[model samples]
Target: MSIRALVYGDVDLNTVDGSAVWAQSMTRCLAAAGCEVTLLLKTRVGNERLTAPLDGAPGVTLRRPYEESLLDDLGPRGLTPEQAVALITRLDSERRFDLVVLRGRRTAAVAAHTDALAGRLWTCVTDVPQTATGLTSAVVSELTDIAVASRLLLCPTEELRGFLESSVPAACGKSVLFPPVVVPPPEGAVGPGTPRTPLRIVYTGGFAPRWNTLEMTGLPAALGRRGVPAELHVIGDGIHRDPAEWAKRMGRALEDTPDLVRHGGRPHEEALRLAAQCDVGLSWRAPEADTDLELAAKVPEFGALGLPVVLNRTPMHEELLGPDYPLYAGEDLDSVADALVLATDPQTYRSAAQRCADASGRFTLERAVERLRGHLRLALPPAPGGVAPERPLKVVIAGHDLTFFTGLAEHLMALPGLEVRLDEWEALHTHDQYRSRELAAWADVVVCEWCGPNALFYARHKRAGQRLLVRLHRFELHTEWPRKLDIEKVDAIVCTSPYYADLTRERAGWPADRVAVLPNWVDVDQLDRPKLPGAQHTLGMIGIAPSRKRIDRGLDVLAELRRRDPRYTLAVKTKQPWDYWWVWNRPEEREYYERAYRRIQRSELLADGVVFDPYGPDVAVWLRRVGFVLSTSDDESFHLAPAECAASGGIPAVLAWPGADTIYSRRWIHEDTGAMADAIHSIVTEGRFDAVRAAARDEIAAKYSLRRVRGLWTDLIISGGFPEPVRPDGTVPAIR
Candidate 1:
């Protein structure tokens, strides 16, 4: 089957810009994958003349919708939404495309309207809204709607995924395909004969508000003060202002730094060549901003050219480069200055550069395009490997959380021809039930959730004949378990989020591909119902303990709300206190647990409007009365409270857990709570209870529904060829 793709965006392949670099590399990769790619460049005024074909990218075909005269008249202001849409519609009418990939706001708007295009349609969103600007909000809303409505939405980073999922109703079940950065060999692969006069540090790429250009200029001065002989080279023109003017201002700010050489803006290859010779590359971005979510492509480009990078600590980089990458946190000048001092040391810089390069392999064009092809299969089937015939399969689920195990078992039981066994083990502090050889011999596939005892058990029991899958929930590694567990014993380690998978790979030293991501599934059909009475004023929180769950935050929100409105009541369902005591290794620590539990219990008892309930089977039914569910967690793998609450027709106001954000985002949370007080106020004042409830149900029904999740599990099991007991309907019998 010939794969034909049409990419629409403001891409100028001739220029050495970030978008251009991406377009060129992606087009090349698609071509290499035997896909015929046509790039439709949305030319702005004066930028039309900049349209030129990339040198090595022969497989890419470029076309401009508007003439050079019209584009030139528009200048840097660019095309309006209506104009861009009209142009894309015209192009769509002329050519039938198999896949239409849109970029940016205007182009996405255009592609959204092009229903005439055949095959699946996808949009690549590169921005997020942090401020309350009208245009930003409008674009965000449009993109959100597009994401919710479109066939696929591709995001470059987990941070962006979080932002999109929280803000956009459309991203609920979306597949996030991280963007790749192509690294071409440096111009001078071999070093010069003699030592260079001075160590050169380069900063290339367009100047944007998020680039924090002023900080880049100050870097040279900082390095000089640290007694390092370095020259600063500024490359790439700015989109907003002249690159030359910005360079001049930077040079002046550095007191006319003697070795500084400002080359304004050069071609991509030339800039890369210069960067390769430099000892270090500098880039900075604010984590809270939208632009930061779209990692600056330059970081990888610098790495590809063998230059050590000094960048701001953004979630995007953290996802791609891992936590150990050399990064300076915060936006303070001193932090940047300190990084500059460390970056100038050739040995240190070179080692860091090598690490960056090694990491870059994961995001290579070849890898990204291959992954994209696999994900896009959801929309378009492969010519040869269409969905295989369903068959009976044996699956085993191992976990401590009875609720999770029950939920999964119920979902699996609903599926036809699939036999799933629940492997329950007593707590490590209790009887050593996990050591039972019968349990190991009884199952074909063993699924272990959480690290500790389960990981150790897997190491002891798993052999060449057995299939072992271990799941790392939030902060499981933060404990000493990952360090102590023999990870090599497991066949596969599953994580709920790619971010966590990457984290595990780094911290646990696991193979990249071994860490598979299988997000938490929900039973959506169960949630289709009207809200229960008192749902408008009743808020619910599910979970016990405070250290990791951050239940205190939820209590704080409830306390503040109750002070303002007596009508507002909070209900909490905590696990039986004795159950925790039984599971805890140190029974003496029961005092510590009891003391903390009593405080929460006492708070609820003292508060006239608060109610605390013990965990029970009817918890789901009770959750229906909760107008909102609170997730005040410090850590989670994939918190089921918000998802369950949503299923139960409850609104969810969630804060970013320390590690949860790596898997689920604020978007998955029914309502995002950046601040506790603000969140409580909104839930009380804004009558968005219905909207939140509806949105939550819609998300669960589409992505996490048992029907949908059953198919995913069936596909995996059938593909892997697991044995199971056959039923009357030729389906797998449910193992009780």
Candidate 2:
């Protein structure tokens, strides 16, 4: 099936605005990329007013939420959440959508929070997320939430993307750049050095306070003192101010010089056509209130028409153009005069115009759209056979957090005869019913990552031809979910360890044949590393929090080991325990952590022997400094950290949890904290540490290595544990 993108625009397409043009051009280009696009708009622009850029585009459909007159005077407002959700549901019922392009801040919020659009939502934030106080306020939290909830968070500039990524690390992988999209000028557009009288200077766009349009009125008088005649061509009007008041102000300024020509708001093409005859473009802004994140589309619009732009200097400008670019100006009229003078110079104008035209290439319709298309290809890879096959198995992995399944999802993407999609619920209970029902209609196999509400959702929605599989780790079985999940609707239940498998099956009264033991896949090759020389005396643990992790136990083992050997040290790579949301909210949990903190402060572990490392990306590099990995958790399903430690040539000293033996050997599993410390000391003193580490690495490589058993997942997805279909004669079936 051809991929479909629902382009949600908040404004009337017939209106001449930057956002409106962006929405129009993107939809047209997406259509050109062979994506069937349905433009769901909230404006009054009717089918007849859909201009040349959109009307003739192939595979394009337009839909509006209200009558043409409902939002005429509202000025670029988006559909309400209810209207957007209703529209999404109506379109989704016709056919499942592969992607949803949410345009503005309000639209992104509406789409990102809507459950049906969860994993498929691509949000484009068109404005900066800052108030007068900057990003340090509560708006930061709102922006962070939007970034975290989106499958891909997009902005129009690299500067904005960098700022957002620095502010919110979770946006690192999902955020993308959607640069300004400019429509190239018509055939035989004027080049640099085109003759124009009185050095005609152009200014296009509204007379907003931040725009500083009044500054342009003085350009003509300033250049007059330098013995150069200049005229200003103002091609647009203000939105927030009365047109008569704005016109009167400009008329008064012109009465003194008569060089300012105020051409009120016109069609986009007509304005650009008028701007083409001008010698230069002027764009100035008030420095204090300006949002430097947005590169004025009017600047590039002039660049495309071969006019050198005279604009203020900002970080975004310095990034797009060289620092030494001649046309940059400050707020003072003298700076504006100097920039215009340089633009009017014969030799200087030629070079500046050429540079401006070249820079405009970055914003061309083909160039900007290609970048968006590349991100789309990464987000929605083509199905096998170069298209969706007739009987292709649609495998949907439904989960709350699938961070551990990232590797498996990559493997499944490459697996032949499968169309896989990950549906990650932002919050299980808050998931949208329409989205769940849509997944039910789309998938042949639904693999629920946790045996909580997701599993219950699939069980309740299980259809005739669809197979349901739920993977339970350790925590869910302790909850009421085990009893809540309907075992009859589920075809299979996967457990990460055999211990949990037996316990869960007995508790849920599931048949033995319906349960399977599948270990979590860890990339062994990526984890294997040479241990550092000083690492021999160091003990390490990962994820030491939530009380169940038994960080206190790890500290006790560290103190005991240090008493025996002064060289021994403990390194913990974990998120700050007190940073968890529950820490400040729950009184009992706060008390527990406060006491733990007091103990650490009083003990020598915090003084010199223990190093608390914050969580980082390169686990393999961190694992190199760990000679022995400690799993001091009170309970766990499989605990991949110890396996990771073994892969990095670190001996595992696991505190015996309920399923400890299923994951680690009995020799490594200890009954108590003191015994675990003794085992590590014995391994080191007897010179058996190296041998144990090597054997552990070998076992992990053989059993849980991603490459070794990816075929098992492929088989499970392709075959669904069903017997081969045979003819009634009891003979082998023919291959179709």
Candidate 3:
């Protein structure tokens, strides 16, 4: 059954304001996750861009019953909390929604009367409005009731969560993280090239007093005195303050530089693009004004563009980016200028860019959807009678590499309401299966990890009413496995990313609907740990024996980095290439490895800087000694090594291999060995190794956690109905 949900917001869906954007994003995430969602707004919106998500979305609906203006609604003329509760109650009866999400203070007020919808109600407090007359008893009572009535309170930042929980005791245990959701930068959207002169700097967002708006005008001139030629580009105008005064002040302060550009204000997208072209981001909020803000949304916006930010140091900044971030500014203009000068040094800028770009991935629509699903899963009530099942879902997992699928099976087994069965097939030479026929006959669902003989065996032997699932990781596509596996008997084909799914459809001519993209599981919680200090100078690579892995490119990157700093070294946690049985037997494979091995030995830098370690038992312990992990693969369905390293707080430098951009933000993706070398230097010299490591860990923890991917597997195999296979004429059958 599809989940049904309703979202309430006090803004028009047509407007491009914070409330509208948040509502649209929340609803869009719900819809994408197979939820039948209805968005209820206080006023009708007319902007086409704001309403675009609802236009073609399946299982999504929008409504605006109030004709009243926004200004009047905030005054005495608006509907009261009781009135909102009654109206929403009536809508719930009509729509039969499974959950109701109330956004903002007004909606939170109405939550008190939503007892009939008890476990179904969730409230989000975007910000606490300061009344002109200050807080009163009536307002306090309403705020407290909001915490008491809602099943969960969603806070966008840790500071906000701390504030809300402290203010109302009832909110302490229930608050969940729901930070701002950023639209990912377009694929292949890169920053302006290196070797740019007169370092370009950009400042975006409103010139609100709290942002310390007027202080930025002197930055370019201050940097100029320090022998650094710089240009300041102001991309936005004053808001919540006098615009005329702002323009007058900026003109006076920047009068010395004829090249200064004050763009006034452009559309958000246009401004973002302009900012992306600049070299650095400036954001300095006054110390006095930094009272309640947990995070600044503009930070992620600039980070998405690969621009390092120069912002005032605060508890929030320290928490988000570690305390050791080098670009943190002080209250004075000189402090801000000094930070900017240090940040624009070609190498310094490169490291900051990688960290900022990598950190931005945690604030995307995909992460938002993952968080939404987790909250919804918990908010859902137990089934009536709470009775245990007679028999659990008997699952048979057949795979050559139990090393890869063992974690997934264990996670599935841990979930309540499901009893799992596992089956490990032998390598071709051994040809042994422990009661494999009995296992297949006894199982309700059978999963094969790779498109090898096990998948073919299940495809040929799967009984009627039994489900067969095959996951085709990288390497499986190029082999003959796709042709051998019979598609007629397979219930589903899982690819790690959409890129590989398309490749399978093109190469194997399999039905598109039969394939689903689900990333491999990474135990992120286990990888989060404190790293050794020496790890900063070490670069690590997992598999280098295969030609497709492009180990030559990795060596080139190592040689380039060693040119800049001799402290840098490359660590290879892999088996010797000659040990592989296929190497000498295959002339092409032997030639590639032998040539690359000779080059490594002949080069002074590689011979002295590179160290090889054979395969080990604990990857987590192995990652502790490595600060930066490199992925120079020519192709991959989904490379799990970099993710493991990142989860272990190691910075990952992935080459722009075929579909790598889909999995990693473009900042960490290097186009060549020169760029990779510059980035590695930038990270270590600027002392941002710890910050980047923390960011990588946070990203992995959010996207690929064991619990999160386990839930997806559960839904795909048991709960959610499977999409019917697509036909050659571009037609699809209804989902089962």
* Model 2 residue 463 distance off true place after TM-score fit, in angstroms: 20
lDDT of 1 by residue, 1-736 (tens): 5667777655554345677666656566666666677776655324322334343355677655454343334444445556665555566667655677766765665556555542256777764454345336677667755764466777775455555655554564554656655656555742222224365667787665456765666655665677766677777665544566766664464456566677765655566666666666777664445244566777777667666677877545665677777645458666876776765555556667777777667667778767666554445443222232264455667666555545456545434455667656677334346444566766666777677676677678765676777768766878888888776777677676556777789998988756766556665533433455568778787765634565556666666676667677878887744566444656554555566556656775325766777665445445656777777766665677777777767665667665544433355442333365466557557976577577766655554555555455444444532212121121233321
For each candidate in the order shown, give its overall lDDT on alpha carbons. Answer: 0.61, 0.74, 0.72
Instruction: Name every residue pair that clashes in candidate 2.
Output: none
Ranking by TM-score: 2, 1, 3
lDDT per residue (tens digit) for residues 1-736 in model 2:
6878888766556555677667777787778677899887775554333355565567988765555443333344556755765677678868888888877666666566767777777778766564435766565676666676676877777556656665665565566777777876766666446535588888886665567776668888898998789888887544545456775665566455468888766666677788888899887888763456778888778888988888888767766666777899887889988888777667778777887887888888898768767767666654433234566678899888887777678667644467788778888675777888898889989988888898888888889988898888777877899798888888778887778778988888888878876677766755665576678789998987687887888888888988888889989898876778865577876777778768877886545788888786457667878998899887888898888888778887888788788767676788999898888889888888789888888877766777644545555666654322222121332222
Q: After superposition, which runs of candidate 3 have C-alpha atoms over 4 Å from their true positions?
A: 11-20, 43-46, 65-90, 114-118, 129-141, 193-195, 218-238, 241-271, 289-293, 381-736
Query: In candidate 1, residue 684 scores what lDDT?
Result: 53
User: Which candidate number has the best TM-score?
Assistant: 2
Give the least accurate 10-residue stretch of model 2, judged by summed lDDT.
Answer: 722-731
Q: Write the per-residue lDDT of candidate 3 for residues 405-465, one digit (tens) a residue.
A: 7657755664455667766766832335547778878888898888898888777778999
Instruction: Please list the Cα RMSD from the true structure of every candidate, rounded to 1 decimal place.
Output: 19.3, 12.4, 17.5
Q: Which pairs of residues collide in candidate 3?
A: 14-45
How big is the RMSD of model 1? 19.3
| TM-score, predicted candidate 3 vs. hidden true structure | 0.48
- Select the stronger candidate by lDDT from 1 and 2: 2
TM-score of 1: 0.52
Backbone N/Cα/C clashes per model: 9, 0, 1
> In terms of TM-score, how similar is model 2 to the real structure?
0.57
Better of 2 and 3 by lDDT: 2
